[model samples]
Target chain A: MNSAHSDIDRVPMQLVQGCLVASVQVELSPEVLHVFQQDLLEAVRRTRARATVLDLSGVSILDSRDFRSIERTLEMASLLGAQPLLVGIRPGIAASLSELGAQCAGFAAFSTLERALEHLDSAG
Target chain B: MIELGTMQIRDEEAPVQIRVKVLGLLVSLGADEVLATRVATAASELSHRYQLLGAESRCRCVLHNEYSSLLVEFRFTSAHPHPETTDLEGIAGVMRMGRNGTGTDELVVQIKLPMPRDGLSKRAIARGRERILQRSRRELMDELRAKNAELEAYNETLEETVAERTRELTHANEQMARDLSAGSEYVQGLIPDPIEEPVRVDWRYIPSSSLGGDTIGYHWIDDDHLALYLIDVTGHGLDSALLAVTVMNVLRAGSLAGVDMVDPDRVLFALNNSFQAHHHGMKFFTIWYGVYQPSTRELVWSGGGHHPSILISPGTEAPAMLEATGPLIGAVEDMDFPAERCTVAPGSRMAIFSDGVFEIIRDNDLVWTWEGLVEFVDTLRGAKVPLADALLQEAERIKGDASFDDDVSIIEAVFP
Candidate 1:
């Protein structure tokens, strides 16, 4: 689904088992990221998912602003009664995130979708 | 003998008519071409100014033979008298202020020329008089032709000089470009080869067209401690690259006297003290320095206004970003870089890169953010592609046909 701005497409949000999985594949502008955050939180509330896995394997680069947005999204997801897990950070992206000082210390992280699912499953 | 001519100034054409009458009288008096033109121009200016007073103005010219001198006098009268004759300072040969018999304010400007000598015989005098009248017309035509030739020569010289200066400038610019290209090559050669050891180090470096300031290197401080760093100077070009190379050399040699190379904080502190921003043409740099001890699987790191190193452990989904612990190097005096430690598991990967690695503009004019880089790298997790190749390919894909705006440098170390 398209957001209010026709230029930005919606992030794919799926209800997998008891978790909400949002695969963010496209390059996110600040405006698009804002829309995605709101949509993800709304989806979590509607599905009543206990956990959410944010797949960032498609994101190859991030700036400081985008990093801050992801941090806020994680915080908001937790506030909405869902444990947010960031998964599949590529090596280059991981290096860049560290370089930008986006420690992402507020949420849990998994290297792969399977690992993230297993961790969430065990925790649940 | 005296010849008198009078002209009334009623309109703008009055000055032109007065100049023609004065020039004819001067030429008849056998005056030189230069002197005749000067007197004609001065008479024209005076008549024009006198007409501006808006009164009945009349110009009277009298050519008379006075002893051995031929005197030409131009007298102008205006009903509205203006005694301000200072405007005639550099114009007329002599300006006599007097009143006519009717008591009108009159200005008389006289131009005197030397007459033919009295020693000349009657026959020579007659011939001289005839020659003066005949050659005067031809002389005026010759003077006009000479002036036009002078102007044409001056224009040609000006064009030639402009062309010569343009050629010199083009040559200088081309030489400078060649020197810069050679200098950039030398700087690229300064980067050390990759290390294939307990910690396999692989790096990718692409200098921007303007030669940006990015230098990365890793060296073994001892059998146990391995020091790795990435330094980004404030700008591009020779100066920034030179500063980067200087910092790299010092790091490579572990040459900071009395500072422990294994300690990231101490090393950065010494570097800050050594390369003060004020001393280096006000240039400053950001640096990420880390000392890894394979024995303990621990990395002690510190940064000066630099992005943190990403530590991706084995079996971990999210990589940890190690951020800067201090301000930029050479920017401030007495700055401290506190060291932080993180455990690096076997089969884990750590990447230290400059901001240029991810600060790319996409074809759509949007920046390829760090999030995009992360997602792209995640897809290569199990793939056999090297980290540097993967990053370069992804960057190219994101950038499309556009070249990088800054130098991109990356150092990826895999612990087997």
Candidate 2:
């Protein structure tokens, strides 16, 4: 009985002084991809914030399919006129993004949610 | 190349007769003037007498490519017959080739008039060749269009056949679904509902599919004696359901036949015998039969290829498992499933369940151990809620809120 539970990423999303801060969890499986799509879309529609920080520190095995599904979520956010900032990508995931070629073309990335927030604050 | 019949003009006799024979042969063989001019002038001079009409007509003749023929431009045309015309009678007329591109097409004609030679015109020859070529092209186009239409009709028929097959397949699938629903209902009917007395017995059976081979039954063999049995078929669905029905039928029939045959061992033996006699070398079943005599406070039970039954003390916090000591039913000749009798104290409760209850997993672990089950029984030993409620809760937990991989059955009985 090997009882090793998957250590999934968890995002602690909150509104700090009217800035929306989102923490992301593990890359969801294909079976639950639709759930994240709907949730992200709904959040973007409800909050007309100027910037959103997407946290992804806990994601372990993000692949091309995950990238596409996440891209759809980001597209939905953009449709609501919100600026999405990527944050907390692991070093391994970043290398994989380059290897997959064209799947991540022209996508923005960042290291931490705090840094993404600072960058947005400076631009604002 | 076209071969013409030989002409019969005699040698060195009539030069005019030889000339007409040479001209006719060239025309029949479709030779150009350049080729016809190759014929010997001696032959042409001898054949020259045929072109002379009643009046002299000036004719210029030239032999060009071969020694066998000549080209003659004659300036004579008349309705009057010629002196050498009888010699041309032995030669047959021209044989025109069919327009199948299978014959030589070397013919060319140009007639000139120094006299009244207006009968054979150049425009008439050109029109005749144009008509033949036009008819051949039109026939080819019509054949191609007919073949294309035939192909389209075949494709339409193929599409229609595919649609018809799809409809038939969908109909069969719908019928199969209906049969399964009916089978589930029929199997559910075999198990009795909660007993409507002070003694509460709750049983749950969750089939892996709409129809599975698990059966649980409750019956009163006689006054103060209640029999509870649970049987699981070795396989799933229809085969198991059929076997369960057969076992139920045989037991009912044996009981109805005589009182002596109503014993649990006797009923099971009869079922095993029937299986051996009729369904020999085939299927088998696991059954736990227990007869509870309220008057004697005795639970007379027998096990055959079934999981152990859990017995919980009425007013205590402990439970025990009664393991089977007999072979599975329908295994060999004269196989007898031995019976075990235990004294039941008043207010003592017991639960009989299948392996399905113990096989469930939760959070990647078996839901409960036998020790855990004993502790669980102790928790609900004297609760205000009925034993049926507690058992249903336990079953639901074992099923992980209705998620199970196999059939589940649990029968709880509290002795009076």
Q: TM-score: which candidate is best?
A: 1
Worst 10 residues of 2 chain B by lDDT: B91-100
Tens digit of lDDT per residue, candidate 2, span B1-416? 21122222222222323333443434433543323322312233223443333333222222222234322322222234333322222121221111214432211122221221343234533432332223222235557879888988988998999999998999987887787667767878877778856455777666665466678777776678788888776766677778877676555444434434336676666666667524633677788888887777788887788867877676544565666566677777578777788888776777787666666667787776655665676677557565545665786767568756567667777766
Give the lDDT of residue B388 in candidate 2: 47
TM-score of 2: 0.47
lDDT of 1 by residue, A48-95 (tens): 989888998876444445668888987898999989899987664564
Worst 10 residues of 1 chain B by lDDT: B129-138
Positional deviation of A114 in candidate 2, in angstroms? 73
lDDT at position B261, candidate 2: 39
What's the true lDDT of residue B116 in model 1? 55
Task: Report how far residue A76 has shifted in candidate 2, in Å.
Answer: 57
Per-candidate TM vs. native?
0.51, 0.47
Poorest lDDT segment (10 consecutive residues) of candidate 2 chain A:
A1-10
